[model samples]
Target: MLKNLEPYLEKTIFNSRWILAPFYLGLILGIVLLFIKFIQKTIMMFNTVFSASVSDVIVNILVLVDLSLVASLLLIIIFSGYEIFVSKIDTGDHVDRPSWMGKVDFSGLKLKVIGAIVAISAIDLLKSFMDIPNELSNGEADKLMWKVIIHMTFVVSGLLFAIMDKVVGDTKKH
Candidate 1:
């Protein structure tokens, strides 16, 4: 009786992976929302182009870049996470299929996520710097300081993640 129950239990547990399908669908919705915001920002930028200063234009462009990066990061997560944890995407002989779609494992996903985060953080910091006032109040100064601190933290964390991955990879090789 115990031997018969073991196979049934294992099969049930394996089939439970389908529970994650809804989560990937939700991420697809998130990408659609990002697209809407991207379009809105583009329209606003176009309306203000003649009146905007170079710095303002640059900041607007950075905002668009930031959105694009986030959307791209979401796409990577959706594809890689689904493949790693749920199921392989069946893109049979598709010309447009991303080369990296099936290649990124969980470890690679982690690095890509962190790298995108560091980049996004850096862009935010740069935008804040560009908007700095000639004279900052205590609150403003503190806020800017905290932004710098947070950005540095992300940078350090990304480096640590890379180092740890490298160490693990080297260990596996040996």
Candidate 2:
């Protein structure tokens, strides 16, 4: 009877593998978009400096940082998602998987992504404050203060995750 049930269980597991196909396809699509964003940001950066507007130059620098953050996120998803849902990445004899592809666990990647996002948001808020008219009576200072608080929260969370990871690693060694 156990032998008879074996084939049915194997077949179910095999069929379930196809469910991940669509998700992998979406990841491929995301990679393409990230590449496009990289190119666009490069062009904008060059153009901004040529136009000689100090504000535009600063904005373009922020955009470059934003693009880099997005690229990091794309890599985390593509590598880890494949490893988790598809197969172990064949790193071969490579000491480190392409320098950037270091052994980042899921929690570590999440913390990094959250931290990057928070930094980007803070930069955007700063840009907005710079754009505000000097004569306006609106409380721009208060808004900037709130953004700083939110950014600090993200920083603290990321630090906590890093410390937790270190503790877990040490426990495993012992």
Candidate 3:
């Protein structure tokens, strides 16, 4: 009978969270890929450090910063997403464990993601600005304008996300 199968169905549904385990594993792989790129960039930066102009050095540094932010963002997502949706990470009192590992909930995760995105966008914008030549070609000018607009969009979106989260939190209190 349908009623007899209710428990079985419920248990099956509960066990389905394991389906997301592969996704978290994939994200860990992504972090490894980022690390490889980071090392390559570091070598390139070192090679250029002696002869590159100040602006060139700054731009290279910005590239490294951008990669680092992205990698860190991936870590945040991997840790928080796994905890929030999949399962608890059993980091038993390890000295190097991140303080925020188990503390961030879904709402906090959203804010962190948006904040990282805005930061990455800002870094990209700065890099673009630094690379601008004195003579602004029409195409290059348009591209720069588009980058500014895109960066502004990300900034505004992050602000809106924070405001909405705060509003929802306040509503729950009342």
Candidate 4:
């Protein structure tokens, strides 16, 4: 009787990877939220294009791009995390498939994530600089400097990740 129960328990534990299914589903829902936000921002852009300052319009566009990059990052995490940690994604005969869908190993995913973050940070820094006249008038130099510092931190972190990946990749070749 114990021997029979052993296989049953093992199978159940093996199948327990399904527990992560809901978390991935939740990420999908979050993706939808991002899409909605993007659309909303786009609509606002159209509404304000004529009346908004040039800098304001540019800043709005940058916000949209930032949202898009974040959504893309989440997509990579969702698809890769599911395939790596959970179950295989059996998308047979699916045309319009992404090139990097199945090929992004964990290290590649980290690099892509870091790269996107650096891009986002650059956008933010540019946006802040675009507002420098206002920042100076408002006595916000300290805050502006902080933003620049934070952006540099992200840049350094991305560089470190790339360097480490290169070191590891080179060591593996031998």
Candidate 5:
């Protein structure tokens, strides 16, 4: 009975990785919602292109670019997380399969996430600066300052993350 219990427990523990499947599925749902939002925003931009101020148009374009980056992040997380934690996605020589779908290791995935975050932050910062009204009040000025500072933090953090990853990778080869 003890030996049987041991194998059963081991198998159960291994199978528990399936518990994460639902979370990946939820991310898919999130992607779908984001796509809907992208479509709506695209339509809005098309409709308002003539009437919108140049700054507003640029800000709207930035928003679309930011969404694109977020969508990319979602894809990276879903594919890399699933392959690294759960199981390999067996695409079986499908030409359309993403080149990096099964190739990204956990460390590489972390760096990719950081890179995407920095890009999204930069886009948002650009939009914030572009959106600044001509008559800037003290409160608005403070808010813009904070946004710039936060974006700089993200850029610095991303650079540090990439440097650390490269150092660790080089050390592994020595």
Candidate 6:
């Protein structure tokens, strides 16, 4: 009886591809988020152009860069996660995947994501500083300080990740 049941169990386990269906669904959701970000930035850019304030223009530019970075991150996670854990992207012959996509291993992707996060954090911190008045309340200054500290932490962590990845690569090469 156990032997007879073995094939059925195997089939059930093998047909578990449906479990990964949600990940693909999530990727589609991410694409939608990307589109929304793009549209939001476009509107912001138009608004900035109409406004007379130079600082507002600079802020808008920073926001645009931040959005682009976020979109790149979404693409990395969607493509790499899908390829590594789910299934390959169905790019036809006419469409080519990005060259960096081929080169980024899991460690590389992690480092890149961390680096991007650090950059985004730095931009946000700068934006906060730019908005600060000549005399900030104690609470506001404290909050800004915490943000700067968090941004610095992300910067340090990303640098460490890159260093560790390099060290491991060198060790393997030797």
What tens digits encode model 6's per-residue C-alpha lDDT throughout 69-145? Answer: 78777778767766666566666543566866555678977987898898889888878877888999999999999
> lDDT of model 5 at residue 115?
87
Candidate 1: regions farther than 4 A off: none
lDDT of each structure? 0.94, 0.72, 0.93, 0.86, 0.91, 0.79
Per-residue CA lDDT of model 1 for 100-148, tens digit only, reads 9899999999999999999999999999999998999999999999999
- Comparing 2 with 3 on lDDT, the higher-scoring candidate is 3
Assess the local accuracy of residue 3 in candidate 3 as a C-alpha lDDT between 0 and 100.
95
Worst 10 residues of 4 by lDDT: 130-139
Clashing pairs in 2: none
User: Candidate 2 on 21-113: residue-level lDDT in tens?
Assistant: 678778778878877987888876776677667876776676667766666666677776666555677878787666545466676667667
| lDDT winner, 1 or 6 | 1
Ranking by lDDT: 1, 3, 5, 4, 6, 2
Candidates 4 and 5 compared: the better one by TM-score is 5
* Candidate 1 local Cα displacement, residue 82, angstroms: 0.5
Candidate 5 has its poorest 10 consecutive residues by lDDT at: 165-174
Scored by lDDT, model 6 comes in at 0.79
TM-score of every candidate: 0.95, 0.67, 0.94, 0.84, 0.91, 0.78
- Give the TM-score comparing model 4 with the true structure, all chains together: 0.84
What are the runs in model 5 whose C-alpha is more than 4 Å off? Answer: 1-4, 172-174
Best by lDDT: 1
Stretch of 10 with least lDDT, candidate 3? 165-174
